[model samples]
Target: MTDDQTLADTTPPAAHESPAGGVFGDPTAAPLQPPTVRRQWSIADILAEARVPERYARVCLRADLEADHERILTELRTLIDVEGNIIEAEDASLGEETNTARAHRLNDELEQIKADMAKATWWPRFRGMTSDEFAVFNKEHYPKKDGASLEDYNNQLVAATMHEPQVTPDEVAALRKKLGMKAMSNLIVKATEVNTQGGVDVPKSPSSLQNLTRQ
Candidate 1:
């Protein structure tokens, strides 16, 4: 069909063509065959030979077996990636739901604690109460009606009575007497002494005395 094929068919043989033998060799001699022509394949031919329908074919069929294998693997990988995305989304949603449930439970506990604290008269000043104000408040622990629950009241009482800043009745009496005194310096001194005995001592200043006297 091609030019070489025509030449192969018609070319005359030279006596010195080959060192091995003439074109007509001994009866058992191997004749020279024409050079092989490389075949060009179409997509249809490639698919027919590939045979992916019935079962997984081995690499021997395709010319570029490695390249073809990578393509197949890439498709499989894409499918796997899609499934993984769906699974990850579900896991994230479940985690968020769990966190929300936990948050609600903690909130309920906090509200219960607040309700309990509401029943006491003078609650611990931890959140907002200052040492100076608490010193004035002393250990006055009582139940309040606003948000105080009975349990909160009981806890407050236990906390208040246990290890309270000891205030002697004598000291209160002395402070009352000192507060009634007309001299500001004397009143300040007495308040200081009362605080010292109560465990959280405050320094008495003459400036405070001057202010009180002016008032």
Candidate 2:
């Protein structure tokens, strides 16, 4: 053999090794397919894939009900809060309505809500609060015969605890109850806005999601 031919004939073949072993290493193995690139979800892409053009509907809430709902919500929250607490004779000066009267009104309003609104969406928010939680909240905010603002109450509480190295169990309990009440207020406010039927206006669909039958 010539020098180049001799070198070619004597050289070992490259190892028939495959990074992907098992059946993949076989000489007759299929070619490695490229990995798929998943496209990110996009609202515009979703719209483009639709078989039909989208339509829109408009809903209008009653202006007067929208305006008054806040007052109603506030009253309900207060009623839940002060249901069985010993309110000082002085703190009772806010309105002619006694705590009993206020509570009665709240019950009436809740009955009205149950009658008019979506129970699954709205009722659970306020109903979850226990009587003790409401009482603690009312006590924390409206102390018996005390004209202290919430900030003042906090400041006094902090000052009282300043000498201590860590919060006492009672202090911790009080703080947690105060936070719970604040959280309940937020939840109640949001629940008050859940259903279109709660408003004086007729329930209507959004400007989007047009009804196919209507068109």
Q: Give the TM-score of candidate 1.
A: 0.17
Residue range 35-74, candidate 1, lDDT tens digits: 5986787999875764111111011212233354455444
Clash numbers, per candidate:
12, 2
Winning candidate number (lDDT): 2
Local accuracy of candidate 2 as per-residue lDDT tens digits, 1-215: 11111211223347556554443334455745645986785999865763311111111222233334556667656555356552433466765768677667766775665444332222222111233543464467434554323433332333222222333435633544444333333322332222111222333333233344468
User: How much does candidate 2 score in TM-score?
Assistant: 0.22
Per-model TM-score on C-alpha atoms: 0.17, 0.22
RMSD of 2: 32.3
Clash-forming residue pairs, model 2: 57-206, 57-207
